[model samples]
Target: MTWQLRRAHEADLEAIMHLETITFVHDAWSPTMMARDLGDPACFYLVAFPPDEPSAVEGYAGLLAPRGAVEGDIQTIAVAESARGRGLGRTLMQALINEARKRGARLIFLEVRADNPGAQRLYERLGFIEVGVRRGYYQPDNVDAIVMRLDIPELESMLVETS
Candidate 1:
Protein backbone atom coordinates (compact mmCIF):
# COMPACT_ATOMS: atom_id res chain seq x y z
CA MET A 1 0.00 0.00 0.00
CA THR A 2 2.80 2.39 -0.79
CA TRP A 3 1.48 5.63 -2.26
CA GLN A 4 3.17 8.82 -3.36
CA LEU A 5 1.78 12.27 -2.88
CA ARG A 6 2.39 15.12 -5.29
CA ARG A 7 0.88 18.47 -6.10
CA ALA A 8 -2.37 18.00 -7.98
CA HIS A 9 -2.46 18.98 -11.62
CA GLU A 10 -5.18 19.75 -14.12
CA ALA A 11 -4.85 16.26 -15.52
CA ASP A 12 -6.03 14.88 -12.19
CA LEU A 13 -9.30 16.77 -12.35
CA GLU A 14 -11.32 13.81 -13.64
CA ALA A 15 -10.17 11.37 -11.00
CA ILE A 16 -10.46 13.94 -8.24
CA MET A 17 -13.95 14.87 -9.39
CA HIS A 18 -15.01 11.23 -9.44
CA LEU A 19 -13.68 10.68 -5.94
CA GLU A 20 -15.38 13.84 -4.71
CA THR A 21 -18.70 12.78 -6.19
CA ILE A 22 -18.49 9.45 -4.44
CA THR A 23 -17.02 10.75 -1.22
CA PHE A 24 -19.25 13.76 -0.63
CA VAL A 25 -22.28 12.92 -2.74
CA HIS A 26 -24.74 15.63 -1.71
CA ASP A 27 -22.01 18.04 -0.72
CA ALA A 28 -19.57 17.53 -3.52
CA TRP A 29 -18.07 20.57 -5.18
CA SER A 30 -18.71 21.04 -8.86
CA PRO A 31 -15.93 20.47 -11.32
CA THR A 32 -15.83 24.18 -12.09
CA MET A 33 -15.48 25.08 -8.43
CA MET A 34 -12.75 22.54 -8.04
CA ALA A 35 -11.02 23.94 -11.10
CA ARG A 36 -11.13 27.44 -9.69
CA ASP A 37 -9.71 26.24 -6.39
CA LEU A 38 -6.97 24.41 -8.19
CA GLY A 39 -6.03 27.53 -10.08
CA ASP A 40 -5.94 29.74 -7.02
CA PRO A 41 -2.41 30.63 -6.07
CA ALA A 42 -3.30 30.85 -2.39
CA CYS A 43 -4.34 27.24 -2.25
CA PHE A 44 -2.34 24.05 -2.26
CA TYR A 45 -3.72 20.76 -3.55
CA LEU A 46 -2.20 17.32 -3.50
CA VAL A 47 -3.20 13.98 -4.95
CA ALA A 48 -2.08 10.54 -3.96
CA PHE A 49 -1.37 7.70 -6.37
CA PRO A 50 0.14 4.26 -6.22
CA PRO A 51 3.72 4.21 -7.47
CA ASP A 52 3.06 1.38 -9.81
CA GLU A 53 -0.06 2.93 -11.28
CA PRO A 54 0.51 6.64 -11.55
CA SER A 55 -2.88 7.37 -13.07
CA ALA A 56 -4.77 5.70 -10.27
CA VAL A 57 -5.53 8.44 -7.78
CA GLU A 58 -6.28 7.02 -4.36
CA GLY A 59 -7.09 10.33 -2.65
CA TYR A 60 -6.68 14.07 -2.65
CA ALA A 61 -6.57 17.01 -0.25
CA GLY A 62 -6.38 20.76 -0.37
CA LEU A 63 -5.27 23.56 1.95
CA LEU A 64 -5.74 27.30 1.83
CA ALA A 65 -2.79 29.26 3.21
CA PRO A 66 -2.77 32.75 1.80
CA ARG A 67 0.65 34.30 1.72
CA GLY A 68 1.72 35.99 4.97
CA ALA A 69 -1.43 34.78 6.72
CA VAL A 70 -1.30 33.37 10.22
CA GLU A 71 -4.28 31.11 9.62
CA GLY A 72 -4.98 28.36 7.14
CA ASP A 73 -7.91 26.15 6.33
CA ILE A 74 -8.24 22.56 5.31
CA GLN A 75 -10.35 23.10 2.23
CA THR A 76 -11.06 19.44 1.62
CA ILE A 77 -9.72 15.94 2.07
CA ALA A 78 -10.87 12.54 0.96
CA VAL A 79 -9.63 9.02 0.38
CA ALA A 80 -11.16 6.54 -2.02
CA GLU A 81 -13.15 3.96 -0.07
CA SER A 82 -10.71 1.30 -1.12
CA ALA A 83 -7.87 3.32 0.33
CA ARG A 84 -9.36 3.81 3.78
CA GLY A 85 -7.79 2.36 6.95
CA ARG A 86 -4.37 2.39 5.35
CA GLY A 87 -3.49 5.73 6.97
CA LEU A 88 -3.98 7.72 3.74
CA GLY A 89 -6.20 10.22 5.49
CA ARG A 90 -3.60 10.70 8.19
CA THR A 91 -0.92 11.12 5.58
CA LEU A 92 -2.95 13.72 3.71
CA MET A 93 -3.71 15.58 6.93
CA GLN A 94 -0.09 15.62 8.02
CA ALA A 95 0.92 16.89 4.61
CA LEU A 96 -1.56 19.75 4.84
CA ILE A 97 -0.43 20.59 8.39
CA ASN A 98 3.21 20.54 7.41
CA GLU A 99 2.47 22.84 4.51
CA ALA A 100 0.65 25.22 6.82
CA ARG A 101 3.59 25.20 9.22
CA LYS A 102 5.94 25.91 6.36
CA ARG A 103 3.79 28.86 5.35
CA GLY A 104 3.94 30.27 8.89
CA ALA A 105 0.32 29.59 9.73
CA ARG A 106 -0.21 29.88 13.49
CA LEU A 107 -3.59 28.21 13.36
CA ILE A 108 -5.34 25.80 11.03
CA PHE A 109 -9.07 25.27 10.82
CA LEU A 110 -11.63 23.02 9.18
CA GLU A 111 -15.30 22.11 9.34
CA VAL A 112 -16.38 18.52 9.45
CA ARG A 113 -19.93 17.23 9.28
CA ALA A 114 -21.24 16.68 12.80
CA ASP A 115 -22.34 13.20 11.84
CA ASN A 116 -18.82 12.24 10.84
CA PRO A 117 -17.35 11.26 14.17
CA GLY A 118 -14.66 9.21 12.53
CA ALA A 119 -13.29 12.29 10.84
CA GLN A 120 -13.66 14.23 14.07
CA ARG A 121 -11.60 11.64 15.91
CA LEU A 122 -8.92 11.81 13.27
CA TYR A 123 -8.78 15.58 13.58
CA GLU A 124 -8.59 15.23 17.35
CA ARG A 125 -5.68 12.84 17.06
CA LEU A 126 -3.99 15.48 14.90
CA GLY A 127 -4.48 18.13 17.64
CA PHE A 128 -7.60 19.93 16.40
CA ILE A 129 -10.20 20.88 19.01
CA GLU A 130 -13.83 21.74 18.46
CA VAL A 131 -14.19 25.51 18.40
CA GLY A 132 -17.73 26.01 17.25
CA VAL A 133 -20.65 24.50 15.38
CA ARG A 134 -22.53 25.69 12.32
CA ARG A 135 -26.05 24.35 12.27
CA GLY A 136 -27.29 22.94 8.98
CA TYR A 137 -24.10 23.98 7.28
CA TYR A 138 -24.18 21.14 4.84
CA GLN A 139 -27.20 21.67 2.65
CA PRO A 140 -29.64 19.15 1.20
CA ASP A 141 -28.43 16.69 3.79
CA ASN A 142 -29.08 19.26 6.53
CA VAL A 143 -26.01 18.26 8.46
CA ASP A 144 -24.40 20.42 11.12
CA ALA A 145 -20.73 21.23 10.80
CA ILE A 146 -18.27 21.12 13.66
CA VAL A 147 -15.64 23.81 13.44
CA MET A 148 -12.22 22.72 14.65
CA ARG A 149 -8.93 24.49 15.10
CA LEU A 150 -5.37 23.51 15.85
CA ASP A 151 -2.67 25.77 17.21
CA ILE A 152 0.28 25.10 14.95
CA PRO A 153 2.88 25.63 17.64
CA GLU A 154 1.08 23.26 19.99
CA LEU A 155 0.85 20.62 17.29
CA GLU A 156 4.50 21.08 16.50
CA SER A 157 5.40 20.54 20.13
CA MET A 158 3.34 17.37 20.26
CA LEU A 159 4.98 16.08 17.13
CA VAL A 160 8.40 16.90 18.50
CA GLU A 161 7.87 14.75 21.58
CA THR A 162 6.34 11.91 19.61
CA SER A 163 9.23 11.83 17.18
Candidate 2:
Protein backbone atom coordinates (compact mmCIF):
# COMPACT_ATOMS: atom_id res chain seq x y z
CA MET A 1 0.00 0.00 0.00
CA THR A 2 1.19 3.50 -0.86
CA TRP A 3 0.98 5.71 2.20
CA GLN A 4 1.54 9.43 2.41
CA LEU A 5 2.56 11.59 5.32
CA ARG A 6 1.42 15.13 5.99
CA ARG A 7 1.31 17.69 8.77
CA ALA A 8 -1.74 16.96 10.90
CA HIS A 9 -4.44 19.61 11.00
CA GLU A 10 -7.52 20.34 13.06
CA ALA A 11 -9.71 18.49 10.61
CA ASP A 12 -7.86 15.28 11.29
CA LEU A 13 -8.56 15.24 15.03
CA GLU A 14 -11.51 12.81 14.84
CA ALA A 15 -9.51 10.33 12.83
CA ILE A 16 -6.40 10.81 14.96
CA MET A 17 -8.32 10.33 18.17
CA HIS A 18 -9.91 7.22 16.76
CA LEU A 19 -6.51 5.62 16.22
CA GLU A 20 -5.18 7.06 19.46
CA THR A 21 -7.87 5.47 21.62
CA ILE A 22 -7.62 2.12 19.88
CA THR A 23 -3.83 1.96 19.68
CA PHE A 24 -3.22 3.16 23.21
CA VAL A 25 -6.23 1.50 24.71
CA HIS A 26 -5.08 1.82 28.29
CA ASP A 27 -3.69 5.34 28.20
CA ALA A 28 -4.97 7.29 25.30
CA TRP A 29 -4.82 11.05 25.56
CA SER A 30 -8.11 12.80 25.96
CA PRO A 31 -9.51 14.34 22.81
CA THR A 32 -9.51 17.76 24.41
CA MET A 33 -5.80 17.56 25.13
CA MET A 34 -5.05 16.25 21.65
CA ALA A 35 -6.99 19.08 20.09
CA ARG A 36 -5.10 21.63 22.12
CA ASP A 37 -1.78 20.09 21.19
CA LEU A 38 -2.70 19.89 17.54
CA GLY A 39 -3.35 23.63 17.54
CA ASP A 40 -0.22 24.48 19.45
CA PRO A 41 2.48 26.08 17.35
CA ALA A 42 5.31 24.41 19.22
CA CYS A 43 4.07 20.95 18.34
CA PHE A 44 4.63 19.22 15.03
CA TYR A 45 2.28 16.36 14.27
CA LEU A 46 1.97 14.10 11.25
CA VAL A 47 -0.55 11.61 9.99
CA ALA A 48 -0.14 8.71 7.60
CA PHE A 49 -2.85 7.58 5.20
CA PRO A 50 -3.54 5.96 1.87
CA PRO A 51 -3.77 8.68 -0.78
CA ASP A 52 -7.13 7.45 -1.92
CA GLU A 53 -8.83 8.02 1.45
CA PRO A 54 -7.52 11.27 2.85
CA SER A 55 -9.58 10.94 6.00
CA ALA A 56 -8.25 7.50 6.85
CA VAL A 57 -5.52 8.21 9.35
CA GLU A 58 -3.69 4.88 9.66
CA GLY A 59 -1.11 6.29 12.07
CA TYR A 60 -0.11 9.46 13.83
CA ALA A 61 2.93 10.90 15.59
CA GLY A 62 3.74 14.13 17.33
CA LEU A 63 6.76 16.10 18.54
CA LEU A 64 7.19 19.11 20.74
CA ALA A 65 10.14 21.12 19.51
CA PRO A 66 10.09 24.85 19.55
CA ARG A 67 12.29 26.87 17.22
CA GLY A 68 15.88 27.10 18.51
CA ALA A 69 15.00 24.81 21.40
CA VAL A 70 17.71 22.66 22.90
CA GLU A 71 15.50 19.62 23.46
CA GLY A 72 12.52 17.94 21.89
CA ASP A 73 9.99 15.46 23.13
CA ILE A 74 8.27 12.80 21.09
CA GLN A 75 4.85 13.38 22.56
CA THR A 76 3.13 10.40 20.98
CA ILE A 77 3.24 7.83 18.20
CA ALA A 78 0.63 5.24 17.31
CA VAL A 79 -0.05 3.13 14.28
CA ALA A 80 -3.12 1.03 13.70
CA GLU A 81 -2.42 -2.65 14.33
CA SER A 82 -3.38 -3.47 10.77
CA ALA A 83 -0.85 -0.93 9.52
CA ARG A 84 2.10 -2.18 11.51
CA GLY A 85 5.34 -3.76 10.13
CA ARG A 86 5.29 -2.06 6.77
CA GLY A 87 7.74 0.58 8.00
CA LEU A 88 5.01 3.17 8.72
CA GLY A 89 6.07 3.66 12.32
CA ARG A 90 9.68 4.22 11.35
CA THR A 91 8.63 6.57 8.59
CA LEU A 92 6.61 8.59 11.06
CA MET A 93 9.55 8.68 13.46
CA GLN A 94 11.98 9.68 10.73
CA ALA A 95 9.82 12.63 9.79
CA LEU A 96 9.58 13.74 13.43
CA ILE A 97 13.35 13.40 13.84
CA ASN A 98 13.83 15.54 10.78
CA GLU A 99 11.37 18.09 12.14
CA ALA A 100 13.26 18.15 15.41
CA ARG A 101 16.42 18.98 13.50
CA LYS A 102 14.72 21.74 11.57
CA ARG A 103 13.48 23.21 14.84
CA GLY A 104 16.99 23.13 16.37
CA ALA A 105 16.55 20.35 18.89
CA ARG A 106 19.87 18.87 19.97
CA LEU A 107 18.26 15.78 21.41
CA ILE A 108 14.93 14.02 21.49
CA PHE A 109 13.32 12.14 24.35
CA LEU A 110 10.66 9.45 24.31
CA GLU A 111 9.14 6.88 26.60
CA VAL A 112 8.10 3.37 25.69
CA ARG A 113 6.16 0.83 27.67
CA ALA A 114 8.60 -1.61 29.23
CA ASP A 115 6.45 -4.47 28.08
CA ASN A 116 6.55 -3.29 24.49
CA PRO A 117 9.74 -4.85 23.16
CA GLY A 118 8.76 -4.15 19.59
CA ALA A 119 8.63 -0.44 20.19
CA GLN A 120 11.81 -0.62 22.22
CA ARG A 121 13.54 -2.37 19.34
CA LEU A 122 12.37 0.27 16.91
CA TYR A 123 13.67 3.08 19.07
CA GLU A 124 16.93 1.26 19.48
CA ARG A 125 17.28 0.92 15.74
CA LEU A 126 16.73 4.68 15.46
CA GLY A 127 19.69 5.21 17.83
CA PHE A 128 17.76 5.84 21.04
CA ILE A 129 19.26 4.47 24.25
CA GLU A 130 17.53 3.76 27.50
CA VAL A 131 18.37 6.38 30.07
CA GLY A 132 15.93 5.77 32.88
CA VAL A 133 12.58 4.35 33.82
CA ARG A 134 9.33 5.87 35.02
CA ARG A 135 7.81 3.34 37.31
CA GLY A 136 4.07 2.94 36.91
CA TYR A 137 4.07 5.68 34.35
CA TYR A 138 1.14 4.17 32.56
CA GLN A 139 -1.61 4.67 35.06
CA PRO A 140 -4.29 2.16 36.02
CA ASP A 141 -2.34 -0.44 34.07
CA ASN A 142 0.67 0.36 36.25
CA VAL A 143 3.11 -0.48 33.50
CA ASP A 144 6.63 0.90 33.77
CA ALA A 145 7.87 3.23 31.11
CA ILE A 146 11.37 2.99 29.71
CA VAL A 147 12.71 6.43 29.11
CA MET A 148 14.97 6.74 26.08
CA ARG A 149 17.07 9.49 24.60
CA LEU A 150 18.50 10.15 21.16
CA ASP A 151 21.15 12.77 20.54
CA ILE A 152 20.52 14.15 17.12
CA PRO A 153 23.51 15.20 15.06
CA GLU A 154 23.79 18.56 13.40
CA LEU A 155 22.87 17.38 9.98
CA GLU A 156 21.11 19.60 7.52
CA SER A 157 20.28 16.69 5.27
CA MET A 158 17.70 15.24 7.63
CA LEU A 159 15.17 16.05 5.00
CA VAL A 160 11.43 16.01 5.66
CA GLU A 161 9.43 13.98 3.19
CA THR A 162 5.77 13.27 2.50
CA SER A 163 6.04 10.22 0.33
Best by lDDT: 2
Q: Taking the tens digit of each residue's C-alpha lDDT, what string does model 1 give over 1-163?
A: 8899999988889999999999999999999999988998889999999997878999999999987899999999999999998999999999998889888898999999999998999999988999999999999999999999998865546554543
> Model 2: clashing residue pairs?
none
Name the weakest run of 10 consecutive residues (lDDT summed) in model 1. 154-163
Write down the lDDT of every candidate, Cα atoms only: 0.93, 0.94
TM-score of 1: 0.94
TM for every model, in the order presented, reads 0.94, 0.94
| Model 2 agreement with the true structure over 1-163: per-residue lDDT tens digits | 6699999999999999999999888899999999999999999999999988888899999999999999999999999999999999999999999899889998999999999999999999999999999999998899999999999966754456678
Model 1 residue pairs with clashes? none
How accurate locally is residue 31 in candidate 2, as Cα lDDT from 0 to 100?
A: 93
CA RMSD, predictions in order: 2.0, 3.6
